[model samples]
Target chain A: MLNKHPALLKKTLSAFAVLIFWIAVWYAAAAIVGYELILPSPLNVIISFGGLIRGGEIFAAVGASLLRVMIGYIAGVAAGVITALLTDRSAVLRQILAPMLTVIKSTPVASFIMLAWMFVGNEKLPILVSFMMVLPIIWQNTEAGLSAMDKELSEVAEIYELKFAKKLRIFIIPSLLSFVIPALITSMGLAWKAGIAAEVISHCKNSIGNGIYESKTYLETPELFAWTAIVIVLSLIIEWLLKLLGRRLMKFERI
Target chain B: MNEYNIKAQNITKRFGSEIVIDNFTCDFMPDTLYSINGASGRGKTTLLRILAGLDRNFSGILDIRGKCSVMFQEHRLFPSLSAVDNILELSFEKKDPALTDMTMSTLSSLGFSPEDMKKYPDELSGGMKQRISFARALLFKSDILILDEPFKELDENLRSVISDIILGESKHRTVIVSTHEIPEIFKNSAINIQL
Candidate 1:
């Protein structure tokens, strides 16, 4: 029942209205500043966006960065879910992983990026950084989901003599997905931000971070703004797609 | 003579410090629709759990029981799955040879139409969800049926629907139903056990 989509045209119109309001504020700020270099106006950024799109390099950069983030995201989700499952089964295993999870959660992303750059080098730096950023979130959410399982349900399975595989398929996975789906979608945005940051620091070729670096180095403020806008839009789009995927996976519940 | 017997010998259970079931003993005979009737918190559910081998920490023994399937006090339907899917899941796990027909027949006997099967627990009324939970318990392969407050939150008509199903199904099986009230329909057929 909750799966019903909101009114599409209404949502779109409201989104545009907000965008326009923000653009007006940005234009005013840019005018007061009296320099494109300090804060590019909305029009300058739009023009820069047009110029960047025409070059065709933006596509390659987006593609390269997206691929890296995706790889890292998948790795994180798999590792997190599996680890959570194992730890949930045994208190000993949970005790062992507790400190490690804490460290992963508390440490800064920049530090991880620098460490990853040293170890995995330029090409794999974003992938590692994104992986680090995503791992604890997915793990914690999966743990939450698994731990929230109804003990009564497990007793039901026991009396019914449900096999391990059947219990996992019927009750465990669905319960886990309910918790993990939101975390998965949230981690996508986190992954993109961390991945792009790593790319910028590592100066990877043919990546969004490299594009940002080039734009800023040559004093192309509008181009930098354009790249930032692209990052924001892509993150939103990817998050929406993941939500659709979540709905499909939970189609039985109608979301 | 009883066709089969489950002898409960001095069964006792305690929750923390309070003794809910204190050294109770009884024999559960087969081919009978039995109701454990008591007021709330009289350990009726607790005794059923013990009899169903769900509460093994009890002091006494409930011997000579075939496989037991239980309907819990709560609905316990998977909120994520539709009514049909919830029933079919356990049936599939049991590897029932005639899965579709078995599911359809059992649900139909419980007064569920084909269309109602596709709706999830949230979509169904409380009574309908209770009926679905009842169907899930009934579908499992077991000779001994244990129902804990099975008629809860249901209308008299729905209760009659369930009563009729139990009356028909319990003729050849040992059915233990726990409830606060034994419905008018079951008075003639059901053996009342006060807990």
Candidate 2:
């Protein structure tokens, strides 16, 4: 379904050509230098990826990572959305909770992970870290959505004597969805990246990060590159799925 | 004090020491059409907003009866919804059929086809949007209908059509419209309050 416009095709082809040229340069440099340890060619990376796929460890690592990240990300998003709703309803509660979440947002993920390690298992560290990273993002965006809701729409609701549930279901949810979808997509990516980072640092069992750690310790450069590729692909797949779900949820026909 | 269905007594409104409505008083009787002709920025829309209970910061002693509806100068139809859905949002179950038929009839009267109800606001022209807004306001069951220059954007023929519809439909209800054009229509047993 890609467009067949000549200019667009030229641009796309030129970009791919540049990518191939770079890979060729890397291969040439490895051959001229005559050192496999210093610079492994793209072929070596591909061979390593194929070997890993044949061994079936890549899918296992990817599945483990995806499950952990999805669990933590969904929990973070739910908590953040609920907290935002609560704060939006009560100014006093917002004032009380605002500074604390602000501090959480400003704090470093590494610091949160290390602190979390003191009280939780290594398995829980990734989830906690991911939650911490995603909470502020979802909360801030949801609060912004609530604040940006049109006053006139509320006036229309009042003029018609729309009940609380009707107003929330018909008006507020749509307003919130418009804002939350983009924010949630953004936060989910952050959650996955931070969750894997936490797992790598904590050396969690049966995780992609553990495989990354194992590869690094054994000086398996190709394996490290493969895992990185897996992470990128997984992240892209997740974001694409979220976007599809978001578009389905925001069917303007229903609105 | 007057024997009126709705009364606004010495109502005053200010925005940060800038007085908008200074002790403004008015009376409106049931089943009568009144036009409040006013200059721009002279609290005409603000007064309508206050009467619609959207603005509660004003100092006013007003008495109103029954449910109220308002038609803003800018057609405030939801851009995502169809004209029929916009009207149906404010209608009651008991009057659903009557409201729908009336809404469709009004739109048809205003030169809109039957398929117009299936179109979203963005697809419609400005005057078409205004007609939908007018239809929504007129079809809603309300005692006091506040229209802020509902016929401002229509052409001569459309304006006349809307004016006649407004006059005819509001015969049993109190209608307060703010407009500068067509002042002669209000001069016949209709109160003309000039600001």
Candidate 3:
């Protein structure tokens, strides 16, 4: 309806206005600093970003980084779900895994990257780090979801004599999705940041992290800003895509 | 062989220091309607839960012969599913045209329009949700149908209609219903168990 359309338009316009205000503030800060080396202007960063796009290296870097993080993210999600299911069924397993997961969650990402570097290659370190960063988040949320399931609904399932698979499909999965989707979206940002940090620490080749490191090493501040922009943009795009997928999955579940 | 569909012997349920049900015994026959009448907090739901095998923290010898379909006092419809899907999810025979037809007809009999069938629980009124819950219990293939406070939110006309439907569908099953007061339609036909 026209009412909803106007509300949506207003929201988009408000977001654009906020973005423009921040950019103007950045421009003023850059001008006041009077040094491109210290603070690159928004225009200079945009130009640098355009040059990187023209060079076509940004595409390869983005692709490689995306693939690495996605693989780790998927594996982490699978492991977390499996672990949660196992632990939910057995208190002994939950007690055994609880301390390990707590350790993983509390450990810094940089420490994990450095520790993993000794055993894994530079290229694979990022994957391991991303996986570690995501595993606890997904596990905690999935476990909470499992515990928070409606006891009454479970009674209904039992009374109706629903099979295990049917009960999972009709009840467990849908309930878990509500918790998992948010955890997934939140952990994705963490995974990407942690993966990049790992790559930077390890100096992995042909990656966004390596590009940023190289730019910093050469004191190409504008290019560094440009690479950072790319990360932000890509993270936003991925989060948006995940949100869309979540909506579709929820719809399918309802059906 | 046992002659009863369900037989409970000397059942006693307690929550810490408080006693909910004390030394209760009963036998439920097949193809019979029984109404459990009691005051509030008089262990009606507790007894129903025990019979449905949902509660195990009780001292009792309980034997149930066949599958049970229970409509709880609360309309516990799945929030994510549409009204029809909530009913249809119980059908072990999935995608059966006859089952779908039966589901539609059953919902229709409960004053649900075709449009209403597509609505989720959040979009339905309390009475409508109760009807959906009732319809789900009626449609599921079970030998025992247990309903707790099934007519709490319905008007008199709806109560009459639902009681008739309950009577019709429970002809071949053991029906154990819990209500504060037995409805007039069930007065002559149903066995009253007072607690």
Candidate 4:
């Protein structure tokens, strides 16, 4: 047990050391540059972060952006799953919708943000953009997962004449969830990036994107860096939480 | 005493012109075990797949009645679940507790104790997992048990134990097993079908 303990500790510390080294490199580079306007040091960014926290603007902006992104994320996941199910059931529907989905996936985020801003209120523009950005991701992955499902399992279902709920529980959901959660984790990152970009373009009030816009106008490089850091940190936290939840959900599935 | 319970008539399966099962016909009866021995790539798995109602592309007329359960040779246990959960997947909510309890008893007879039931597929050895797969099929309580070389990885002693348990448990049902090794099965009254 003692020998095993050291090996596990070594592995854990190695990962931690990598993170520390990167932070150190970042700090040194910022200090060497010596231009707060161009590259604010980590300390300056932290100070800016502290200032924003004290002012309560950071909290409001994060909350607003989070809410919008979550709404859009949920909508996109729902639309993607329902559309994939429909297309799976009918080849005609797949043919009709395939081109449009492809175009949506390939189009640039900025272009969608601008176009979406025209059709909806500025507040809703970020949500719509996020939804548009995340839909194809969930659709394509989920369809692939469904396509790759073991035919033998479906045979079992048919042989037993399993009901709809039982079929979903026993076969379909397990296969789909394996793909969907990973897709969702990836799409959440995309959603936040795209959603915030839309907010920045739309100049929505009380949003992190608007804070970024303000930092740019004022040439507050540290503020910009600080907000960017916040975004990265928040996204990481959410991703970690989501992954934990995904694991728990998998355990509960009895798969 | 011999009534043709299930019949496969003119069953021809073709995969893009290469025939897997070529115009095969067979009949099965209750309370008797049927064993099929054939060369490799001789449509053994294909026949089982068709009989399990998984393959519909084959040209055939199958007159089958009553419930059917199958145990593929691959031991297709769900990788993430424990042994007990895999068996439970085949069971219905409305099934008799007595039947489910009998399945547990069968698992015990095949050397899978209650403690082993808690372990996942990756945690168990190949032979142990195979028995879990066998346990699942037996627990399904079907009219016909479609087993495809279920005792592949077991040692002689374990194989004999499983064979005895299977023979004893399936007295009332028709059991069809496919295997290339005929001597290992040791079923005295099985109608041997060579494909």
Candidate 5:
């Protein structure tokens, strides 16, 4: 088994070595600074993380943040796919939605959060912000996937007279997944980050963003680092899950 | 029922300023084999595409009586599917055991091992992919079979074997094949249309 996956093993070991190197540098830097408020060591952050976990507030914060981000991510992905199909089929719709999506893509997330705060409550602002951040990315990637479809395979479908549902199952969905999966994995990190940022700005209750904000306001540098570590770990886990899902879907196509 | 399976009249195809096929006329009957012989860029693929209803940009009078199954010049197998699944996806009786058996037998005849049937298109060689494409066209239930350069990637022995299979399958349908030159086996039986 080790021989079969030597490359994957090597990659993991390399990543671990790089992480160790960075942590060592950070430890040295913290020692040189000689002040915990300025730069907390890795051990200081771990102790702070343990305190939060023991207080049971971290669970609630993590759960609330995850729920907000998941709601926005699911809705954004669904809307993106539907709109891409509509624009791909109709030139008029494409013309109408193109400029609007372009503007959304170019606009700053912070500005959108500030604007959304006016219309939405503190808890809901994060959902809207994450949705806005994810929509254009999924849309652009899905559109590119549709445009890059093999024309020859479409001609084969035409010649074979495949039914609409069959064509979608055998050709369209499989082809689109190649592009859509990467977009989904990429957008997941963006959605999580944007959702947390909106929470921090809006002062959403019972969220990791709230925890981070409180830590920063209280001058608890170690706690701030702990919250940031949680964010990074969650993003990596979500991306890894998305990749596994993509692999399973592609495996279904092969069968 | 129409006497002619396909009747194309005064078909003129042009790409921008260059003319490919100009005022070409042909009448194809059912249960006959036709070899469309031409050099590269002589519009054999274009004319076949037109007849198969894949290209509608040409000015022509075309009437096709039945469904068409095409083997494209390139092996257009789905990259995600195994060799057997690629052919099975196009079968009308996909759930039937006989269909699966027939697919396996056809693949076996075309030089595919049991292991080869489970391998995806990317894992297969160029000649193997071409044979899978040919198997798909042969197995699909259609009255008209349009094959564009079907034997272009095969060895001489495989070509002769594939030619025999094509001839054997042409007893009930109209088979139109495009090639640089007519194979020796098809020279006596196939109507050669030179462009």
Candidate 6:
């Protein structure tokens, strides 16, 4: 895997050097602060992560948060794809959705969380917020893909008088992959952050957001840092998986 | 004796205020060969696309009577699909035995090997890419086969072979060939139209 890309080795070395430099800076900052309450060091966070893991409570929180994110993500992808396809076929629908999606995208996550908290149950608030986060990104990217589709494909379809399902499977999906894969990879992280933010506001019984909130409320600075670090790690892992899937989807474009 | 015919009447095309084809009229008889030869920007490709039912932006009464297969000027093969996939995909039937066999034979007839069939368009040379597009056009086995500059990048030997094949295919089907190298396709054409 080290030699998978042309500059993979060089990139890996540079990335590691940057990581070490940041860790040293963090260590120095913690030494200067001399108080865990204000700025917990990287080592303290790691140790706190291990202690949380040993109690098995972190697993429940992670599982609950993961379930919420997955559900919201899948639903958002479905709705976004359908909406994009609808808009692509009709100028009216495109006009209607343009301002609506702009409003959704422009509004702050905190505002959306507040609205969902007022309307939705605490358990579903995270899902709603994550869904909101992923919708416009996927829709816009997919719409762009459909707009720039190869004209030859439609000509071929009309020449053959191909059925709708056949055209979708052969031409549409494959063409959309060039756009959809990257959007999916990007939105995974966005959805995770949005969902966690909603959970912090909603006060779900067993979730990472709840743990972070409790830590803050009780003045457990190390635990707060530990939860934040877990969120970052999970986000990275999910993004990595999405990128791997993107590579697999784009295998056809490679020789 | 023509069972099927394609007729165009007083066709006019314009891009903005600049007219491309002005007041053109023609008739393409069935079971015959036609060659459309013109200089660059004379709208030969545009005319072919109109006749094949691919372009409708032009103001024309073009009657394409039967199923038509077209090889565009720029070898518009799908960049994401392999050679065989590009030919066989976008069809109603995904796995028809007869269609698959015909596609394989057409690719082979066009000098494409099995290994070449698995390669993507970017992996192919310009000549190979055009050959694949030609093979895909033939795989349709339509009543009207429209080739636009089909032999521009091909070598002499392959050109003769493909020319002979087109000539043989034209005997029983309506073939419309448009090219800059008129002599390659002109030898067997029954009606030659110069725009």
Model 5 TM? 0.89
lDDT sort, best first? 5, 3, 1, 6, 4, 2
lDDT by residue (tens digit), candidate 2, A1-255: 237588888888899999899988988987897766656677887887898899897787778778888888889998999999899999999999989897998888888788888888788888888888788889999999999988887777788777777667667888888889999899999999989998898999888999889888988887777777788888899899999999998886343
RMSD of each: 3.9, 3.4, 2.6, 3.9, 3.1, 2.8
Per residue, candidate 1 scores C-alpha lDDT tens digits across B1-195 of 564657888988988899999988877777788888999989998898888887888787778658888888887877777898888876456545588788888888777899998888888987788887788888777788888888899777777888888887788678999989878877878888887
Candidate 3 vs candidate 4, lDDT winner:
3
Deviation in Å, model 5, residue A214 alpha carbon = 2.7
lDDT of 3 at A158: 75
Alpha-carbon error at B76 in model 2, in Å?
1.7
Residue B136 lDDT (model 4): 80
Q: Against the true two-chain complex, what DockQ does each candidate achieve?
A: 0.44, 0.37, 0.44, 0.26, 0.45, 0.43
User: Model 1 - which docking category?
Assistant: acceptable
- TM-scores for the candidates: 0.86, 0.87, 0.92, 0.83, 0.89, 0.91
Tens digits of per-residue lDDT for model 1 on A42-105?
Answer: 9999999999999999999999999999999999999998888899889999999999989888
Could you give the TM-score of chain B for each candidate, in order?
A: 0.89, 0.90, 0.96, 0.88, 0.97, 0.90
User: Model 4, B170-192: lDDT tens per residue?
Assistant: 57888888887775555475778
Question: Which pairs of residues have clashing backbones in candidate 5?
Answer: none
Ranking by TM-score: 3, 6, 5, 2, 1, 4
> Over the stretch A113-138, how does candidate 3's per-residue lDDT look in tens digits?
88899999999988988888889999
lDDT of 2 at A246: 92
lDDT of each: 0.86, 0.81, 0.90, 0.83, 0.90, 0.84
Descending-DockQ candidate ranking: 5, 1, 3, 6, 2, 4
